[model samples]
Target chain A: MTAGGHTLQLFEQRFGALRRARRTESIMLFVILVLLFAVSAVWTDFSPTQILAGLPRIGEYFEKLFSIQPGRDTPPVAVLSWAHVLGGIKEPQSIAYWFYRLDVYAALLWQTVQMAILATVLGYSTAFALSFSAARTLTANRTVVFLTRRLLEVLRTIPQVVLAFIFVWPFGIGPLAGILAIAIHTTGALGKLFSELNENADLRPVEGIKSAGGSWLAQMRYGVVPQMLPGFLSYGLLRFEINVRSSTIIGFVGAGGVGQELKRVIGFNIYEEVSAICILILLIVIAIDLLSARLRHRLIGAL
Target chain B: MSASVTRHLPKIPLERRTLHWGIGAGAFAYFVYLLWLFDFDRIFTGLPKLWVIVRLMIDWTLFAEWDHAELIHSMAETVAMAFLGTFLATVLALPLGFMGARNIVPSPVFRFMTRRLFDGCRGLDQFIWALVFVRAVGLGPIAGILAIMVAETGILAKLFAEAIENIDTKQVDGIRSTGAGRLAELRFGVVPQILPVMISQALYSIESNSREATILGLVGAGGIGLRLSERIQINAWDQVAYVIVLILITVAAIDSLSKWLRLRLIGGPAARG
Candidate 1:
């Protein structure tokens, strides 16, 4: 009984030492994180005092957004009512009054959707063409893979907004510039995703095609394409959803979309209109998300 | 042998073949219509001006005269904003994550509300948030930080909740067998399992947020984007090129560093190898 107790004591001692070491490590990690946080807060000028001051202003901004402002020859209306929401544009408090330029915004939003679609198509095609070369598992030439990967990296690393900013200089301020910018970024992003998927693809079919004396292109066509098609389509649809968001914001750089209208309303301090446009954008985004999610679910389920 | 092989091949139904052709033709027609609508002719017209900008960027004349210090400072500010924002979001998300997780919350109604709250936060783009916050707080990195914090909180919370939901229930059951209270059970059981995942996700957010924070300055929420937009406005292609290069390097560096840290913390395949 004493011997057994002695061994138990030794085991407890070792376990206790291990626990102490782990505790110290965790404490050290916590200290380091805290230090980093403090430094970052100082560097960014982030303070509780600043936030406290800003909180009221943020609330005020929201209030201004929701409340109706006086239009030319109209009275300011403070409270929101269902009647006001469903009333005509002549009423200052009306949703119709706030979204008076719905036709224009709608056209711009359509253009945004078109830009997203065109960019997605363009990016998807290019990414599909390049992915085979970029994938390490498929491509034999290291140099080709290396160069393609680097190119994709450069394309992906540059933010779509920045790319749109540059394209605006060359392509001029329109949806075309936005399309090119978004397409290029999408190519990079989707190329990486596609190549990764390709790398993970089952390769037995590829070997079988090779044994049949298929050329590299033929092998890829018959062996890999069938397996990767669903994944590509799924990712392409996902990219379309993301591209819609990108196309919306690319307008901020004068690349064409409802974003320019948003920037205009915000710049002019048309608070009600800002909220109106935000509501529209939010609804559209949610709709696209749901639709694409359903489509993706079906695609995966079919697989 | 060739004739016999051809005879053995299964023929596609006529209706299926027609459907395929119709789809192909329809897609082609639609693509053509969109091209015309978008005025594809502009590419040919715009090529000369595009070449001019590209050449000017490549030339990099007066490269030494560029304001390197200001560029570096803005880049640092961007990184700082991302770091601070992500840290704060992670802190705020920990509890929200628990509240949202299905296994933890138990109340489907509460979980649904929490998830919808996350969706609302995430629905608006970070740029939109930055724009609003800029107006609210006045122009600075502070606005950028808040925007990032709000957006990242939603994202990190959702991710953390998913991670928590996927945890091994057996471990939680074991901890419960010790007669520990709810908080104790969570601290010992749930937190330990999901801590690594939470840290990794937060680290990834920090990396992406760094890239995002660069552009928050376009709305006057301070960062390198302000400088970039200023240069673009002034038609300074050479300086723009330099800034783009710097951004690429900084983003890449952050990405690799975050990856390394994640691997070290999480013990991935590389670590195991």
Candidate 2:
């Protein structure tokens, strides 16, 4: 065979073989994934039959959650205007009408945000202190490192809700219990993140400080903390975002906040009140997210 | 001499550090005040009870005769709930991700609306979603899964869309040069570019959802949570401790596994952590 022809033929053969191999690999992967999902579905009792039966109930629930609408049989207003679109504040169909308890909602929202702020501030500070030892490159005493890390892990592993549940016993059912619960959980979480940042820190400064006979505290304050502060603060901010959401949930178990109120409204089947409280909570969370994002950007820029 | 002095004298002099120290001191004082106001007396009185609770939680001897099979089952259920919810979230998010991507959808209105919808979904905390789902589905892992699925979908879509928008559009142009249809171009180009990110995001979601799901049981949405709550309520400290142990192990294992996979697939260690 001509050399050109032989090279072309070889290229085709190799390309075909590669394509076939890829196809088989993908097919096998697909099969395995399908099998896994199937088994998981069965275990979770998420069968199609169950979903179909449950879906309408979900629709009904949402129907109640949505602000009251004009009855299907109600006659159309003769005129359309912006004012008409906004159901009257006292009108049952208006969103504002549903949330008429705005003062109560606002107070609860403020309390919830306070809980998150306090918890995050306290937690991140503790995390900042603990992270030095938690960093593998920094700690001189292995025992201290081991103990600190284990402590953080245990703090993180237990749910904040559970901790709050326990704390309620000592502090009584109030924001204090909620704050402590979230703070402990935050310490574990932020410590891990902070330590990772510490681990990744530029060590030259630390080594420089050490060679000059710097004290352990001096090494951290001058050498490690500066490099990691921005990252730590960023993570702390993110944790605050998460804690804000969690503090809302912890309230349901009598830890105190808007969530306690939310739990009450939900239990009584007062769907409109639930919707109002929910809307308020949603707005607070979004505001926090936007504010935090802006703050992080500015902080990083400054650093 | 300057460098030596720098090392000898900490970077910030004591006088200069006063402001920083003051902030810290103020925070500490505020915390103490809060604690004091919150019935600090109760804590001192409660210390004895706290020790008993801690001892109960730490003592494995009490867990020896606990129902091992049930504990194992609930642990499995927790993992399964995380897995199932994450899977559904990823599946539900993928299409919306495409719609939300500004590069993909040229219409600003559509893109804006899609993003707003995502923000709205994430704004409501997952606990509320769980409560809503429990009401809807009548209490089970299915409700937990659905709640997680709904709650995560918007956030995942937002992440996925951002990843899509950042990809090198040159690849899509290269695929287009071959006379491929839009769908084919996207299939051959966009999907591959986004696959690594999508997988990592999904895996990360499952890890986080696992933590969140552990508590969904508190809302009766299904997981080991209901059992945990039950144990806590009934003062079955041993069982509660055992369940807590199981959760810690599972969470740590999954976390390491996901990190490893992300590192392997993405070709980088967690340097940014």
Candidate 3:
């Protein structure tokens, strides 16, 4: 064959091989994924039959949640009406009756919010202090940076609920346990994020401070803290939103919050009360999310 | 000289300084109130108990005596639930994502409703969903998996929809110019562009879901959380410490594995970004 013909043939051969390789690689990945799914499905006992069997029960549970049960004198109701929803607590089908313990729930919800706020503030402060030490660019001592990073990592790696479970023992089953758990977890998470912000901060200011014979603390405060303060606050606000959700549930371990009430109602199978509390939690979470998002937007805008 | 320096200095605003002090004092007051409300005195009283638990955990004398098989199995179950949940959610989210994407659907009302549905699904925490499912499904890894699936479907769908909306329209146009149909255009143009993002997001979810799955068992969803809680209930501090360490290792392992897979599949600094 002519040299030109040979070159063309070789190019085609190489292209075909490349395509074949790509196809095989994708096929291999697909097979591996399928195998993994099969194994996980078996291990988790995820059966379609089970889901199908449970579907009606799930429907019934939800139906029960929407309808109010008959009181000692009231007749059984099949469905809720607008009138019933807006009716007095004496009306068995009324939402007010469904949420008869509103005052208790409200107080617990408030405590949940307070826990979130306190945890956020405490965590933010602690993380802010540790972040400088954790940041390689800010900390001159490598050992300090390494140790601080590891400490933060360990703090965050354990789930907050598990931390709360442990804390319940120490703190005796109250919001204090929950708050401390959330605070420590937040500290770890925020510390890592803050250190990253510190690492990315403008080094010129730090250099200027150092050249002026400033100490490490002075350099960090004058140089890095101001630059990253907005980011820190933004993250802190976001964390508060997350902590609200966490604190709401941290009571599952008896670490004070509305979650404890939720777990109780759930345990006792008080379907209407369960739905009411869930709705309340949802509203609070959404409200906090909106507020925090607005705050963060304004903060970023100002900066 | 002092008078000259004073004259050269800029005048600070009085109200601004007062505002700063006011905010500071108000925050401090709130903090103090919260401290009192949460019963700050408990810390001192709790110190001894905390120390004892801490010491017991660190002792490690009976570490090998603990139930290794059961703990390891529970840990594996947590990982499996996370993987299965994330996998199923990713599968379900793809279609929902297309429906939710503005460019794909072209109907504002439908997209609005879909977005709201996503919001509703996301509004509840995974733990709460786990509790609900535990009640529904009667407590097992299935409950945990379903909970993760429901919660992650919402999150992944939202991310996928955003990814779909952000796709390069020129590619779709190019495919359409080649006499390709709508489905063909999507297959050739859209899917290719968004697959990497979807995979990355799914992998990220898996990492987080593993952490979450560990706790789902607390609500009777089945995982290491059940074991940990059981141990805690029995005051088995040594066993609890073992379970916690195992969880930390498993989570860290999964995190790195997912990171590596993302890097391998995406193939660049873009993966890290």
Candidate 4:
């Protein structure tokens, strides 16, 4: 029998071919990687000694949590009483010292969720409309398609946080600014998604509709939208998950979410409670991501 | 068929006309109300003075008296931080992404768990991660880099997994039928196809993280943003403008370079589309 007939031999050969990295290329890759590491080390102020030294500060910060004191007498000001502080409330000073203000966090979370939902829905629908024109097969207006695509790119190029700050001046420090920020981003993102979907859509139905004398809107309605809906819904679901996390950050600029609270905690050096909030946010994000994934899968499967 | 039978065909419901009119109307109303509240007069009144602010901004960033050298150093630090963070995230994400991919693993349970783990890693904002790292490691660019790396890993991993899953399975299958092991199949069949996408994504992530790294510095992570916040607190609108301009130019340059590189790597239409 030929040597190639052995299964183990074939596997070894395949693996060998895949693993055959040229010495020069491998060296270059290693050099680049090392350089990146070196740059990170240089830019960061973290030294081993500093981390060790900061441990006491972290301890002292925790110690001050159980008692109220002036900034100089201890570390930072201690805001929390003993009970809640002992119960592992991170940043007891930020939460309890301000008058049992978990309510604010709850309220902000609600606002963030509301804004995310509203914006995602709005953005997805607008994308659905604009994508028809943008798709090469769906529309003949080259100028309109090019302009709209460019508009979306410009919109997306501006960071969402920057957009939030810009809108804050106009819309005031409320969920309105945050919602607008997210909506605009969603429009850009979803528009791109929808256009791609439209471009890849089966052409037979569109041709049939056109040949049968359907108008532009009619052709879209009868042929394109149906085919594009599944992809659009999937993209929208994904965006919704992202918006929830981003909405919190937008809160830092007075858009009203958990991020505002986060800023306050950090400014006051409320470390433990900061940890708590981080944990909470992480849980929420994970839950939403999982849920969105499942929902998207089910949605597409149903279609 | 008989004429009577043809005439008696059942009537179907007209295609349901449930357009999203309510959402459209609500959004339009909100836009109008917001526009009115912004008070255009206030903005217009401030516009002419913007030139003076812009001048001040330039001086603060490029020609500041107190710490001109320091500001330049900080700007470099910010770029370095973004580069490190994005590179680390990309490297860490690639393996996890392969595991998380549906088509790659073919084990539903394993994929689900890995996917959730990725979500957990990426779910928190980089700022929050920065806060966490600062406390753990103390405030510095290290904290910033670590924060961005952990935060971005989740997103990059998800995107990478999606790219992998979307790849044509036939090539991988062909490699396997040649008695190739899974790793071999991935290296030869999967890696080549997705490498360009991964590179483009890595560049985009670097661009995005640069913006984010600036914000992380606001909380004392380290970068130009730390100085920017300082100026803002002192109501240095001109300085703020200067810093903004610096950031803008840097970001624009990176964006253009990334686009050019992407086009070069992939044929133009394919790269862009």
Candidate 5:
């Protein structure tokens, strides 16, 4: 009975120590909350009543989308004729016809996915080779590292969206422009990530290779590649997910993807078709995410 | 005998696979030749046109008629959309993050489900969601807000959950041994440790989303992007320049503000370092 009581007292003492350490964190959290509230109050015109009032309008829009059809006055689209083959000739005449043209959206989605994959493969492969040279343990050449790192920074600083806009002018309206833009951005990002992974590699094996009088490439191939593959894969997969999403937006500027379809549908106020395309995009993204996470988990465990 | 054998260890030929260098040189020359064939000198001649546009842009920014107060009003609406979207996403991330965290969830099934939910949200771009919501919400700022919220929340939740999972378990274990409830353990033990990193990252996301808000508005979600797009259509290069400048300034301002707030909120080098 006495020993149990002593253990309880010891537990209380440890709890006291934990509480003391946490006090500062709690205070900081409170301050963050207060600042958030203060900023919101000053910057926004957020009235609870306005949010309440807007709810019915939101429901009305959804209802109209679900019940989309041609009325008596509305012209029914008999067929989607193709005089231009390359462009929409008659524009969508009815909401129902727009929904029927899901093929266009699907084709664009495929283009976006293709661009993302091509860019990720190209960018990650290039970065994988260069990262060996950039790693401090692998090479002591400050000049080489500096130039490579600086090059990466400049590349990454220019967002893919901005690059897409620039490419549109020079390359004209096509997926090629989007692919190039995303590839450039991915190269820089993957390079930085790869170098960091290199820096964190188990140096013992690398040192063993060096002591054996191995060439630089020998050390990299035999020692570095094995350690860094998991990290490289994880980063590349993450970039692929990011690229898929960005590819959609790049399409808006005539880069050729589902984004263009989305824009046209919104402009014409084709509500039902808009919902369908959105649902399609969401599903694809969700699938990519689930697949990537599972792959990452398996890789991390193996490592 | 060993010394003599060691001396005979021939030098390994310098692994100079010159083919790679040769290929690189060839590619560079080919690129230059391609550019030359395309009349790359046109870029220099076009500099003046670019300058003219810049000058017109400056004029619009400083001297254009305020008659279109709608433009300014729309700008505010865009900002409001971003703020609301970011706020909603952050709120959603809290529980989603915990559920997705492997350490917190413990059960593989629950973790798997929540993690997939995070990915699904983040996998699609906000612009796609904007198109969808504009249909359902009927072409307004509300649509923009919803799109940004759903997309950003998914991304933020994944990041937050990862951070949570990577945290030291010792602190949590200590709390659990004290007979604390799960919520209490999280409140006192886990939140404190990761809060600073979370805040700093969240601020960066806010900055990024603000820049993105302009593009989201282009899809009729109601923001400065609509004005920018209209100007581009009407050959109003000057106004386009003006709007670009406005966006640049806003993004730059937010960038600095995030840096400052992150420093203060975290209250140490841990904010960045």
Candidate 6:
């Protein structure tokens, strides 16, 4: 009992000291966080005073994102006025009012979505063709894999907009430029991901196919492709979503999409229309994300 | 031979198989139509221009006469903008994340509202926010920083909320049993579980925001993109190539550095090795 009491006392003493030390560490961490914030605030010119002064202006800017109801007395930010918030298309408060040029915006939206889809399609096919050669377990030549990987790395690092700029010179300011640029970027991005997926794939089937005297093509078709298809498709879908956003922004550079329209209006100081298009984009993007996420979960979960 | 054929055959239902093929064919047909609509005639005629661009990019003489110091300044600004933006966003998101987290707030309505707010912020493209900030904050890297901050706050809040919601209830129960108040409970029970995830996500945002800040600069929000855009506006292909080279190097370097740091933060292979 005496020995037990002695050990318990020692344990208490050690833990008490440790706890104090941990408290000190947390205090230090907090202080360091504060210091980092202070330094970054200075470096980035993030003035709290300016931000506070700018708040009303910022709010005014966002307020412009909304259209006033034809005769509503309440502020746009007022609570629970669903009618004003969701006013009918003809109503000034409605989304349609801000997005008055629905047909034009819709066409641009479709063009942008198509750009993304086509780019992803092109990118995924190329990535699929190259991934087998890139994967270490499947590749016969190490040098080929290394070269392919490096090429993919270089491909992905350059901004897609820059690529769009390059291609615009060739393709002359259309969806073609946007499509080709995004496709080049997707190739690099998707190709890297594809190879990584391929590397992690089960090799048992590949070995089995080889032992059965299967051709190289047959081995990949029967073995690796089946195992990696779900992941590849999921990645492709994610890339498509990203490419849609990229296509929209690339249009700001005169590549193609509703983004060009956005730039046009913004250039003219048509803030309401810009927000309208931005809202439309937000709605579309969210819907696509939620839908794709559902599909992705179901598909990947089944695996 | 018949038995082997039966075993080798795919087991997909006939309707599903037909549906799949039909969808594929329809998609392909539409894609072709879209491509045809896009005027591919320029591709053939513009081959010379493409060659010209290739030659321009290869000409190393562009860098010989340009202002190297200004280029370096812009590059530094880009990195700083990313770091500051990500930091500020994460700071804002900490409380917002708690408010939005179902497990933390325990009120579905409040959590739902907070999450919806975040969604609105995230749903808009990054450039759109940059455009808005350029208007609000005036044209500069400050606008770019704010844009990054606001956009990333939306993203980080959702991620942090999810991380918080995923924490083991048993852990929190231990702290609550001690009669600890809300802040204490959070410090003791909540923060530890999600700290690593938050750090990792913030670090990742830093890398992503660097890419984004470059583009934001194009809209006059300020960064190396400003330089690139100015050059592009003038059709200065050689200077454009020089900017591209700098961007590529910076991106590659940051990627490797961040990868190393991320692994270390997570105590992964780099940390062990």
Most accurate candidate by TM-score: 3
DockQ, computed on Cα atoms, for candidate 5: 0.18
The TM-score each candidate achieves on chain A is 0.92, 0.89, 0.91, 0.77, 0.74, 0.84
Top DockQ prediction, candidate number: 3
lDDT at A303 for candidate 3?
Answer: 88
Which model, 1 or 4, shows the larger lDDT?
A: 1
lDDT of 6 at B171: 77
Predicted candidate 2 versus true structure: per-residue lDDT over A78-193, tens digit per residue: 32335643767866535667778888989888878878888898898899999999998998899998999999989988899988887776567788778888999999999998
Residue pairs in collision within model 2? none
- All candidates: CA RMSD (Å): 2.8, 4.5, 2.8, 8.3, 9.3, 4.1
- Please report the TM-score between candidate 6 and the true structure: 0.89
Off by over 4 Å in 6: A1-39, A62-96, A297-303, B1-20, B268-273
Q: Tens-digit lDDT track for model 3 on A1-303?
A: 699999999999998997787788778989999999999888878899887877788888767755754686775457657886788888764677778889999999999999999999999999999999998887779988899999999999989999998888878889999999999999999999999999999999999989989898899998998899899999999999999999999999999999999999999988878988988998999999999999999999998
DockQ of candidate model 1: 0.72
Lowest lDDT block of 10, candidate 6 chain B: B264-273
Model 6 residue A5 CA deviation (Å) reads 7.7
Lowest summed lDDT over 10 consecutive residues: which window, candidate 6 chain A? A71-80
- lDDT at B122 for candidate 4? 75
- Please give, for residues B1-273, the per-residue lDDT of candidate 3 as tens digits: 669979999987999989999999998999999999999899999989999998998889876688899999899999999999999999999999999999999999999999977877788899999999988878899889999999999999999999999999999999999999999988898999999899889999999999999999999999899998999999998888888899989999999999999889897643321
Q: What are the DockQ scores of the candidates, in order?
A: 0.72, 0.58, 0.80, 0.27, 0.18, 0.57
Query: Which candidate, 1 or 2, has the higher TM-score?
Result: 1
Using DockQ as the measure, what is the rank order of every candidate, best first?
3, 1, 2, 6, 4, 5
Candidate 5 stretches with Cα past 4 Å from truth are A1-54, A68-70, A73-103, A129-144, A201-223, A293-303, B1-84, B95-120, B132-146, B156-204, B207-214, B220-273
Q: For each candidate, what TM-score against the reference?
A: 0.93, 0.89, 0.94, 0.66, 0.63, 0.89
Screening candidate 1 with a backbone cut-off below 3 angstroms (N, C-alpha, C), the clashing residue pairs are none
